[model samples]
Target: MENKELLKRIYLLVKPHRRRLVIAVVGMVMVAGLTAGQAYMVKPLMDRIFFDQEQALLNILPWAIVLIFLVKGLFYYLYRYMLESAGQRVIRELRKSIFQHIHTQPTSFFHKTTTGELISRIISDVTLIHVAISRALIGLLKDLVQIIALLGVVFYLDWQMALIVFILLPVAFTPIVNFAKKFRKYSVSNQQTVALISNNVHETIAGQRVVKAFGMERYEAKRFSDLSDRLYHIIARDIRLNSLQHPLMEFLGGLAIAAIIWYGGHQVLSGQSTPGTFFAFLAALMMVYEPVKNIGGMNITIQQGLAAAIRVFNLLDTKPEIKDQPGAIILPPFRKAIKFRDVSFSYNQANPTLRNINLTVVAGEVLAIVGPSGGGKTTLVNLIPRFFEVSAGKILLDDHDISEVTQTSLRDQIAIVEQQTILFNDTVKNNIAYGDLDRSEDEIVTVAKAAHAYDFIQELPEGFDTEIGEGGARLSGGQRQRISIARALLKNAPILILDEATSSLDTESEQEVQKALANLMKNRTTLVIAHRLSTIQNADRILVIQEGRIVEEGTHANLLADGNVYRELYNMQFKNSNSEPSNLTP
Candidate 1:
């Protein structure tokens, strides 16, 4: 996007606080006027007091100087405070908007993006924007005001010399523009590099056990150091570029001062101007130098801010790929079955994950889906929730099409217990009662008992209120699984999807969680993606999906007797144990 357009968007954000901004601008004008008035005082101070030997002027001069500076300082504080408060509020609102927008994205967006990158954009990039809005933009306005007010003073004192100083102002703009371009390019790279570092840190921390098991601490550290090293070089270039601007500006300011002194001295010596007039013009001209230098510094910040703004707005502009269709009605409860008619799905345009799938899961029947890896078992079930819209065809709940109904109403009737148990860094009770926040404490305990999680809950330090560490790190795999099952139980959803819930458990834990799973699946229409042939032998029917197509469907005994793909898979798990284990990878 063009910087001009980006700036307009920022204006819209600031528009809400225009009243405060106006007050700040008024404060800035006061400071600018006071600065000009201070320079103007040099005339009378020089002429009436010293040159004309007016000793009586001393009585009023000290008080006048103090009052001018006192008011200038007060206005400075007021404007800075107002601008900073406004800037912080902007940052707060932007962060909230970005956070809310991110959650609105489809699940597929998260699959392609890293968690750390999102965090970096939220924290680091927005902070750069804060710097630009509060410091740089505010400084630019104040400096511009100072320049204009000081120019007016110099012109009133002597127009010919005022014109001379004004002519050199544009000379600094070329380098400032060049530096701004370079700063923007580097700033974008800088934000990306910070995201990389954030991603690396997140991965290492989340997978610390894997790193330790592989003895990869030094390797991970080396990787982090490499990213930091890259950031170092980028920032060094930034510092080098930033450092060059002030010196170039200072040199230009020196040239302006030299011209002013030589020209104003000639005027005074030729009696075309008084010492008072020449000195007052020189003072105003000198004051212009500081604002010019400040403008140079503000350029770098605005550029960096612009770069951050690009990433932030880009995220905000992304629309969720999956959202309720206009005029879609709330889905009624699942009754007869979930029907997939000519359903197909592809993660990308080049490859189909599930092809021409036709299946019906009855409202109260347990359907077991078994297949070799990459056979689309989980993907098929996920389609029911509209996590990813089907590439072609439709899914229906009884007579109602799932696509035509609102997702909230559709998902309200379903519960899932995935292979990897997901828990939060919160109390055990809160985790169980997550979806249904209105559940009474007694109800949470009842579900806990039903999922066979009560025993462990009672044993925790704080009983039901015990804090489970990040992702339930403090709990055993079986304990976490049971807690997850308890959560599903509390939801009391009528449709259940179990994606190999016991896949990672040991024999004892598996036995415990299977009891919990049995309690969770009671009377609900269940779809089970199996990793073990033993677990789903009692399913109403077994489906063998291979290479995105259902190759076989029958009772366990019938499929085993037929000695086809289902039999082969059964033998692989029970008889031909040397074959690779079953899992849902697609």
Candidate 2:
């Protein structure tokens, strides 16, 4: 977010429409030329009225004034319309690039950021930058033309009056520059504070269920209020600073005009300057002052736009923590096995979540990972598709390093059914077909039946076309899980991950889901993360994990016989269930 970097990004934004911008600039110059004619016309008209025969020129005078206005109005519309259109197109393209870049960012970015703040950048800040660029560019061009043309008129009428303009320029500019510098700092602070406030509100509303369950509503409200107050204070401060320049410059402009009139009157009465000539010089001075004032205001707008540009550029400049390697090849279909060689990972580098560990699964085997909460079970499965980069070691897919292959190909070969149901607001068939975009109706139905979702789907009002609410809120937890399973089934990837997929279901629902999962795992390489020991009791091999590393690994029966960690865990769940009375006591 350095100054040079900001300018570079702004340049890139305008580069695509350079030809259009040039045309717009030419239009703006024509507009300025027509506008400058008004100042030039005042001198000739004033001289003809006073010195020449007034009646002879009277009829033509009104016509000339009318023509000047006509030309000015035409050029004004052309310049404003063309330049504004160019700015809108450039901003549209910039916003699209930002959205696409965000999509390409690693999944971890979402975990660390809020959607609301990102949305504000894409919408509000972008619009501000667009307005600033378009208006500032056109205004600067017009001002430059006006300054040149008006200064020529002033010097022609009286060189002494032109000196007053030179003196007034710096007096008007110094305060504006100082105000703009302060406004820039405040504007950036205001944006950051507002982003924080927006994030607080979004997170609170999204997690309202937990807030209510824990009776932490007051705490969340207070947190939101504090951030909101900070935003308010910063914005008010920026407004106060921005408001100062306009009035102070207006006062200064008035003082300069007063000084010019005082000095020019003495010259006119002394016969050193004609009354007509003095009026002509004063008209040019008035014309020049408007651009100077506008330039002063435009400086602040430019600074505000630059502040927003810095934030946008910061996002664009960020490097993803996970990305494909240069010259990486796509992974071919799995035929042999998958291996993790001394893998370790962490959300934060200071604390390790997964330790150095080695595990292998044959092409068509089900390897279950059993662990306590936060034992890295979900984290381990996430690594299979490069959702995160391994911190210490490499993971290989059929002897090729996963990092050496493109993410799209690696992910396309794997499917995941998460514990929480994540369905979009779409028809039942669309949700199931989400895993495979090109899947036909038959393929979708076949996969749904295999995942035990077909019966419930048919019973719904619209059957396969029934609209599910956001996140499948219309469906029961078990039904949502089945839909997720159906999605994985339709994918038909060589590798599958079931992360506590059925752990949240009731006993009867779990039994049915386990059957569906078992059938789906028949000929595919599956990685299971189980919280309920019973769900994975029939896995090909079980790895008992504690903290970050594997503590034990064996078959279910063999581990039970060993009477170690797995045996202890199995007995605990079993004893808890058996401890319940068979009949209720009176």
Candidate 3:
């Protein structure tokens, strides 16, 4: 986007606080007027008190200086405080908007985007804009006003000297413009490098176990250090560009001052101007340089802010791929079977994940899907929740299309326990209660007991209140999986989806978890994606999928009798199990 459009959008954010902004603008005007008033007093103070020996003016000149400064300081504080407060409010809203927008995105959006990149945009980028709004933008307005006020005084005292300074001023800005372009380029590179560093830190910390097991500490450290070094170089180049502005501006300012001094002194000696007028013009001329220099500094901040704004706006403008259709009705409770008629899905459209599949999952029935690694078993179940809309055809729940119903209501009827257990860094009680926030403590404990998680949870330091570290790092794999089962049990949904829930557990843990799963799946319409054939032998029906197509379907005994795809899978797993010595206790 163009800078003008970007600034306009930022200005709209400030519109809600227009009253405070108006007050700040008024305070800036007062500060400018007072600054000019101070320089204007230099003439009467020098000519009347020191040169003319006017005792009347001397009596109150010092008092006048104090009063002028006191008022200027008061308004300076008022405006800065107001602007900063308004800036903070804007940042708060922007953070919330970005966070809420991220939640609206489909699963595909997250699959393509990294966590650290989103974090940098929401936190780091917004902070730079805060500096621009609260300090740079506000400072620009104040300095511009002060420059104009000071210039007016200089012209009134001596027009010839004022014109000389004005002509030299443009020379300083030429270098500032060039530096600003370079500052923007470096600033953008710096933000991107910071995001890469953040992504590295996130990955290393989350996978510290893998890193240590493989003895890659030195390797990871070198990788992180390389990213850090790149960031340092980018910032150093930016600093060099920013530092160049001051000295060059100072040189041009010095030249203007020298010219004024030579020409004005000659006028005084020639009796064309008094010492009072010459010195007052010189004072205002020097004051003008301060605001001009401030404006030059603000240019760097503005450019950096603009770069940050581009990223933030891009995220905000992103449209979510999956959203509720207009006039969509809330889904009622499940009373009939779910039907997938001619359903097909593809992530990239180049390779279809599921092809022309048809199936019916009756209420209160357990239908297990056995498939090879990439046969789209998980993808088929994900479609039920509308995580990714089907590329073609439709899914119907009791004759009503799933997509026609609201997402929240549809998800409310389903519960899931996956291969990799997901738990937050929160108390055990809260994790279980996440499925149903309004679930009573008694209900939570009952479900935990049913899932066989109550024993280990009670052994924790704080029982149910114990804090589980990130992703339940403090808990054993079996313990975490049971907690996940407990969460699903608490939801008490009519539909359940289990994606290899017991596949990752040891013999002892699997038996315990299987008992919990039996209780949880009592009357629900359950869909099972099994990696181990033995676990799903008791399922009411089994479908053997291969290459995104159902190659066989029947009971375990019937499929074995048929001696087809299901029988092959059963024989393969049965042989593998027999090869390994049994760990089961008699």
Best by TM-score: 3
Worst 10 residues of 2 by lDDT: 577-586
The local lDDT score (0 to 100) that residue 586 gets in candidate 2 is 13
**Candidate 2: segments with Cα more than 4 A from true spot:** 54-56, 455-470, 578-586
Worst 10 residues of 1 by lDDT: 577-586
Q: Predictions ranked by lDDT, top down?
A: 3, 1, 2
lDDT of 2 by residue, 1-586 (tens): 6778777879889888777788777777776776667777776677787677588688887898898788777877777787888899988998998899898889899988778779878987787788779887567778888788788778877887778778887888888788878878887877777777777777777677799999998898898888888888888887776677778888887887898899999998999987778887778788887898788878777888888887787887778878889999989998889999999999897999999989888988889899788888888888889988899898999999999999999999999998667999899989998956678999998888877788889999999999988778789888898899889888889999998887667776677667777887888999988877878878888999889888899888899998488988888878857543111001
Our tally of clashes for model 1 stands at 0
**Cα-based TM-score, every candidate:** 0.94, 0.92, 0.96
Candidate 3 Cα misplacement greater than 4 A, ranges: 576-586
Task: Write candidate 1's Cα lDDT for 1-586 as tens digits.
Answer: 9868999998998889877788888898999999999999999999889888887798899899999999999998899889888888888999999999998887899998899889987998888898898788877888898989999999899999988887898997789888888888898888889999999998899899999999999999999999999999999998998888888888988998899899989999998988998888888888888988888888888988888988999989988999889988988777798898999999999989999988888888889999998889888888888889999988989878888888899989889887678999999999999987789999999888877789889999999999999999999887898888888888888998888776766755566666666655667898988868877877788999988989999888899898499887777667845544332211
Model 3: how far residue 204 lies from native, Å: 1.0
* Reference-based lDDT, each prediction: 0.86, 0.83, 0.88
> Model 3: C-alpha RMSD to truth?
2.3
Best-matching candidate per lDDT = 3
